[model samples]
Target: MRKIERSRMMPIALYRYNLALPLAPFQWNMSQNHDFIQSAQRTISLERDSVDALLPRIGADFTLACELLLNCKGRVVVVGMGKSGHIGRKIAATLASTGTPSFFVHPAEASHGDMGMITKDDLVLALSNSGSTAEIVTLLPLIKRLGITLVSMTGNPESPLAKAAAVNLDASVEHEACSLNLAPTSSTTVSLVLGDALAIALLEARGFTAEDFAFSHPGGALGRRLLLKVENVMHVGEELPQVSPGTSLSGALLEMTRKGLGMTIILGDDGRLAGVFTDGDLRRTLDKGLDVRQVTIDQVMTVHGKTVRPDMLAAEALKIMDDHKINVLVVVDGNDRPVGVLHVHDLTRAGVI
Candidate 1:
């Protein structure tokens, strides 16, 4: 056998193997967690800066855009391409909810038959960051031919889309949050903020009310709070917990348990609201070593219980509960007689919480 030097032979083989192989990506000397955090911070900072840049540009063009939409006989027909299209949809939704009738149509889809959605009475609000997006540009002539007012939001004011628009709302941003400065990061955020600004400005100009907003968002929690009346959430009929002042504390407890409200409204002999007896009163009474069977509810009940009207908003009832740090409210009519009993649980269950 030939005398073999294993270490020298292995070194030659290893050097040749290393020369043929590429470096592993995971072996790169960098902290991934640190990079992630740094990237997040940089993106947020860039986007925030872009949003700040929009504040100063709320000028005459913005006013003209508002005016055109406000005067339009038909809905606002919003058009955009790509990322601009996504932001346009949200803008339309916000406008629609805030009392200004609006809807979005994709520029590409508009070219392919969706253009019929736009009419002479409609006001077209087009979004194109570059102001030269071919799809949106193609619809400009059709929009103008139909005598529809065109409002353009873009970073490039000198571009064709801006030049063609009746009003150009400049949405130019300093830079993008993307490391390559090409992705729609800061620009999209600025566009969204500007759209919200427009919606809110028009909302205020039209004197939009919470009740109006509630009507638009009927299935939402805000609607339940604004539209659901006190009577709607209050326990009425036999579900209401009521007792006479002459009733014993033990009797009130039975009423509370029976009604599942943790409290009972106390009525005077005249049938008016005399007071309220609650589980908290039971605790205090117990702490005082009072006999539940011996004491009348009038002795242990809370005098001048918080009350609400049947017509009051459940939100108002919630506010009263929060202000008083109490969980129950007695609904009374003009005669001061208990019409219903409202519990915090009822408000919670009704989605008014």
Candidate 2:
């Protein structure tokens, strides 16, 4: 081991030798481990199929679960332990971001005092690999008596937790991804898939729109989608780099460069939008050898420029800019006067892209 570790090429040579020599018991078991993953793939495909088959089979209990959640006046509380707890937290987040108010509560902590987070108007979704986890089972009676709706996710349908739930979604699979078929691998996958199904179904049933989703997820991609109004990130007032329509092309060029936006908005005498001047216009002007000092900006600026309303979405503005093949846009008010300027680079810096 020391000789191989110190040599530059010897390590690679030894590694190849070790791999070539491994045909005994250890290698035989190693090959089995690699092939066993095929079973894992089968498990995921089966779980996906189960989720697809589940929608139609929702039946009355499905309506009951939705009603239980829809009628909930308080938050939906999720509880679990171990691997199930991890999946529960994600489910809780999905529910919260998709219009349902929800959060995760650890069963151990619930027995201590966190149970206070759950109210009679709420529903409890508990996950347990065996429906008989002592920590989870102990809380069942208290949850049931509190008049909180109980839903359980478990691989064993007849387990206590499964029997306790007002509705039980069967997550049963043939075996696990564990070599000894003891680990929770396949079961965890099924649980996650089931939670996603529930969250999406409820999202659609409640008519939850992207605008609604943006309200809850105001910190990440979701928040970016909702919280960014055009005006919030636009260059307003003097930063707009604007010029009077009668200004000389030289004055427009000075305004564009001074503002550093590569463009200038041209306003009519009535403070209404008239046109736009940019470096592109400067190029066209130079093609005719027009002297910047003598030419009027009004004669060369592109008239009736494309504009966006101040109330439009930042994402929508990006689409318009992309479609027009322009990198900057003028924001206009109801009077059609330039109110602000938006640069594509500004949106990129703000993570609006």
lDDT of each: 0.89, 0.82
Model 1 lDDT at residue 175: 94
TM-scores across all candidates? 0.80, 0.83
Error of 2 at 195 (Å): 1.1
The stretch of ten residues in a row with the least summed lDDT in candidate 2 is: 1-10
